[model samples]
Target: MSDKILIIDDEPGIRSSLRGILEDEGFNVQAVASGEEGLALIKRENFDVILLDIWLEGLDGLEVLKKLKEEEEKAQVIMITGHGSVETAVRAIKQGAYDFLEKPLSLEKVVVTVKNALHQKKLEEENLILRSKFRNKYQKLVGESPVIKELKKKIAKAAASKASVVIYGESGTGKELVARLIHQQSSRKNKKFIHINLAAIPEHLLPRELFGYIKGAFPEAASDKKGKVLLANGGTLFLDEIGEINPLLQIKLLHLLEKGIIEPEGSLEPIPVDVRIIATSQVNLAPLVRAKRFRDDLFFKINVLPIVIPPLRERKEDIPLLIDYYLDYFSLELGKKKKTMTSAAKKAFLNYSWPGNISELINVIERFVIMVPEDEIRPEHLSLLVEPRELQLTPQNNHILSLKEAILHFEKEYIHRRLMTNGWEVKRTAQELKVTPQELKEKIRSLGIRIAD
Candidate 1:
């Protein structure tokens, strides 16, 4: 659609000429004789640009500009006058006029100014959209528990430093959330925040994904591409599941950390980068280092400011707050009326050991919002999460099983029992095990336990 232009001038000839010029330039133009008519038209319709003569029959241009500023009208206003002065132009600009024009206006100058003003407005809109997206993705870390409070304090401290951070937590424990919180509070918050999950990316493609590649680097490389490391320059690079990266990739990452340079595939020249690294892992890197699976140097490098997010089981007191948050969030999202849970349902949630942490709880709440038709969620709506059974060690099995084998067997039986007790509801069984539903499903797979009768 063409930009809408409103011309407010006392002189009929000036309004007619301005409308003709703007309309011919592919603008939808409307001419008004006074500021009163202009403001009335503005109230009824949206205009991209307004041309107002300073001296009008009633409600002068400056007065209309003040009203527009007060009302927060987004249209760009240009002040036109035969007797234009430097002081008058400055005052009009201060009053939110996009530009000031002298009488006997040059049509070319008018078109250029309007174009620039529209371009500025477009940029402002784009910026607002980007900031809104950033806020949604990097929402404030919720929870007021002691553990959460401590983590917030530590995040504040870490934000002031340039040290590499490593967040340790189980799957679904908000490791990436912590990283984003740190980045948001840091000085580089306005820059990019690039995230890469090492475990998700294939091993053969990992290097090019991190360091980028040049044109003709491989058979599929038709054009040069920028990778996460380069795209994250002067910002933060979040490496999730850092321990899953292979040793060869570890060496490349270590080189980048030590040298602040990346050699893209098929490029000999090393490009300098100024990226802050924030790595997270579900398992302890120390064991991986000791077992010779991960590099000790790399471990030391990323573990500079280690932050451990406690599991939901450890911070069970925050479960209700999380439940309420998800309930309200999903209700609004799903366009459903707010649903309250019965005391028994609440108790069931509190008693259940959440293995997947906040992530699991969010999924459960979302499911309840969609499936639970009642205004109130009752005990039956909740999954049965009985107490986890104790590991049984029979004398016959103890003699044959190694410690690792015995623990594996016990875990298999424990998960199987929970699944059966919960009537094969994966979410409930996972909560009972204090693990995510996905994690529980993985265990069922590895143990070869079939839920089918």
Candidate 2:
């Protein structure tokens, strides 16, 4: 974005001259007559840099800077005054003005100071946005399940203290979500929330990436760069898929945890960092530690507070609520009408083991809503059990049929054919027949169509 410059001066000549110069340099410039007008303009819009004149008609430059600091205290300001003095310059700097300029101002100094101040403002804005985004991304753990409630309580308990947390769960169980919640609830929420996927980064790069590197640290090093740990100073650093890290890096990680310091690549002196570590893994880290694949010291350092996310199958009671959540999400995301689950469909949802967990459920639900044009979801719509099972029309059937003789035969054929058309998933089958899982199961039972043992 082009830099926006706001010029506040009493003299029309000064305001016009500054605007012309800034505009020529490709900056969007706005000039106000007095400090009062400038303050009003500030309230209406955001500016990259401000040029404030010291001796205005009513409010002096110092007064304008003070009030501006009160509103957006971090704003970059360059003070301009005809009566330039050492005391005035010192006072301006003390009041958060970036630089003080004595009139008649050199065009070069004005341009250079404004450019540097705008660049500084841009960096600050980028850092603020990244921090805000990181905080908001972790605010989506919505559930009243006992497991979730206990998890929240635990996060609250651990957030205040400087404890390393380790989260363990299967794939798609929201392990990263749990890790972030811990960071946000902590006292360090306002600080950076740095995240890295251990599995995603290369083994050779992981060390430099986590601990940071110095200028000319290696052949490819153009300049010094702060790593995730340094970025997360005074906050939390999340190491995702920690179990997948290389064994050598595991040892280095242990060293950092023990020392509370990191020696950048090619550096001997260690840089101290005040950062809490939150590590997450899809598999149990304990086993890896025991096997010597992961360092035991590192595991202990990161396992102060442990959280495990139960699979969707284990918490079957929450399936209906999860479905509703996904339905609402997909409706808004796909721009479609609302979808509701029928009683029969809910039963089918309850019966099946969600092998892929919540992620799988979301994908299936999104497709189910978009493809199947139905007001309400029935039993056949619930894609609970997807594995193919051959059910023969035999007398000795476990699921009792609701019909008798020829009607039962026809119903059996109808259900079987529909299952074939649906590729044999309970959810798809229900959608094809415009029935719920409960209805499908009931009809299959009523007709004595049985799964062959």
Candidate 3:
């Protein structure tokens, strides 16, 4: 958008002329006669630049400027002074005025000042964006658990020093998050953190993806293009799923780690880079090395400071807190009212083993919010979960029970146990129990198991 400019002056001619000049220069200009009106405008709208006459009918220019700054209105203000007010102008300049121009204002000087102020504003905005990115990139790594605390400590330690790091974690355990946190807190925070998922890219194109390919280097080469290693120069390059990378590519990565230089695909010139290599893997490194699937030399090179993240099931205590965090997040994001998991539901959640860990829990919570009726989430609100028949039906005097009652009790126990085992996955439970879903539903209904809610 064109920069917004507010022209505030008691002189009618000055206001009109300044507005015309600013509008012609592609600014959104608004003219006000008094500093009072200008202050009101500042309160209600966002402006890029403000030109305030030192003398005004209501609030004085300096008073308005002070008020604007106090209100934290982020805009550049240039004070306009009358002749023989050099002292006043000097004081205004000291009080955060971008520039002081004498009245019978020069149009050229006005335009030039506006341009410079807007350019400075642009730089401020760019700096804000960079800071925001840094904050956002590490936001997912939220928690003060001992594990997380130690992980942050390790990240800070490794980031402060120039060392190769090997992040070890199960899939969906957020290994990438640890990698980003390290880079953001490091000395090289100003530079790039280029990430390449080794397993995601094709085997044949891995070399070209890591190292830039020159024009006519290969069959599809129409132009020279830079690769991640080159783009991530002076910063860090994170190789994700390092266990899946081919042995030859491992050698190439090892070469870069060892020599701090890489020869791009189909290029003879070796480009020197000061990139900190951070590699991650979900697999056990020792088994892979023993099997000869991974090069032992490369493993030793990248595994300088290893960080292991246990699976989600092992960290059940953090699940409830994670649920609250995600609930708040999704509520804001989806524009829904805030909700919480009921105690019964929380009990069911803790009882179930999360094979996919935090990732799986997040998915279940998302589904629960979208599907569960009413404002509160109950145990049955989790459609993703199933229950054993014993938990479903209560029976006394086992021998004295009728055949129909016995069948009902047995069905309830079976269904509830399967549900607990499968995290209440009804369809999977049905399939596992060798029963049609419709039959299972009927049985659950017949035993009043479906009436829990």
Candidate 4:
């Protein structure tokens, strides 16, 4: 569609001339006789640019501009007048006018200004789209369970403040993901977000890596270097696995957290930093503090806002949703056809204990997208990757059971396994067990076996 331009002026000759020029420039031009008419037209239609004369019959151009600002109109406005002055141009610009033009307007300048305004508008729109995409990528938590909902609330409240945050979760439970979400929603989102894993860095060189030294400070110090603290000034610094830091490093970190000052390993002067600390730990710091392995002061300083992420096994109800999300995600990412899982396969997934948590689940789905060739994934395909926990009577438990109770337990397990293999189809399972469908249904009800939808 061609760009739409609105020409608002009282003089018939000026409106006609402006309309002709804009139309010749391949723009869809609409000319109006008064500001009131232009405002009414804007209410019904949208335009890319508005050319408004300063002097109108009832409502002046400035007043119309004020109304547009109140409505938050997206179109760019340019001011035109026969009697123009520097003061008028500055005021118009302050009021959000794209440009100010005199009565003897240069048609060439008009085209250039309008094109520039359009370009600026396009860039602003693209910027908004990119920011939205970035937000969705980092801010999504992908679960609707009660625990997850509460966790999101905590993250939002924590993001609004500048206090230090400490996240607690098991490995593969997305601790760093929560930290990134907090930073993305904070006031300093436009600034840097620096992350360093304490567990990944070597203990012998951690000090130099964190608090960089000046040139000639050491034999290998070739030039002045900025540490993570200094580099993350006015932004956020995420310390992953903060519990892994040694005792000496913990003391230095405590001093920095207390004074907001960082002293390089060999530097004489201490530089103050303005960094928001976000730390994560798989282990509880309180026990470590009691054991004298972690400094109490440092632990307290970084634990102002605490957030805990629940593991996948605890939220089994949300497993189906997570499976669907990852299946679609990996299919699109790998440019493969999305596959469906058989009832047996889904039952297997629900039966397994996800000890590795969401990270493990995501990897498993991605692997299926790349390796599984069939459109319908079955239990055998999944068994290649992980063995689903099955119902069994162990020797220890069997010893405590009566003879009749043991026989009933074995019967239940056998029926349940057969039903699952046949995708919960009663007739097929009954045929395999040499019984009628009605009898099989009665046995299922007596054994209290839950069927998967």
After superposition, candidate 4 runs with Cα above 4 Å error: 1-139, 386-453
- Which candidate number maximizes TM-score? 1
How well does candidate 2 match the true structure in TM-score terms?
A: 0.58
Rank all candidate structures by their lDDT, best first, as comma-separated numbers: 1, 4, 3, 2
Candidate 3 per-residue lDDT over residues 1-453, each given as its tens digit: 366799999999999999998889888899999987787555434577899899888789889888877766668888999999879988988888888889788999999988998888768766974766544522566566788777778878988878888888887788877887788788777556889998888999999888877767888997566778877776789999889988788889889988988887777778776788888988778799999999999888888888898777777777778878777766665668888877666766776556566766766676666666567877655543333224434554563778977876676766765665455556777899898978876775665543121
Candidate 4 weakest lDDT stretch, 10 residues: 383-392
Error of 3 at 164 (Å): 1.1
Query: What is the TM-score (0 to 1) of candidate 4?
Result: 0.57
What shift in Å separates residue 422 of candidate 1 from its native position after superposition?
Answer: 11
lDDT of 3 at 153: 80
Which is superior by TM-score, 1 or 3? 1
Report how far residue 139 has shifted in candidate 2, in Å. 3.7
lDDT of each: 0.80, 0.74, 0.76, 0.79
Number of backbone collisions per candidate: 4, 20, 18, 0
Across 1-453, the per-residue lDDT of candidate 4 in tens digits comes to 477799999999888888888899999899999888898666545577899888888999989998888877778998886764657766988989888788788888888888888877767755864676454432458888899989999999999999999999999888878988898799877555788999999998888777767768888887566678766766789999999999999988888889988888778888776789999999888999999998888888989998999998888777778778877777776789998776677766776556678887777777777778987788667533322323235446446878898788778767867765665567887999999989998897787664321
Flag clash pairs in model 1: 355-434, 355-435, 356-435, 356-436
Whose lDDT is higher: candidate 3's or candidate 4's?
4
> In candidate 3, where is summed lDDT lowest over 10 consecutive residues?
384-393
Error of 1 at 58 (Å): 56
What TM-score do all the candidates reach, one by one? Answer: 0.59, 0.58, 0.58, 0.57
RMSD to the hidden true structure, all candidates: 15.9, 15.2, 16.4, 18.7
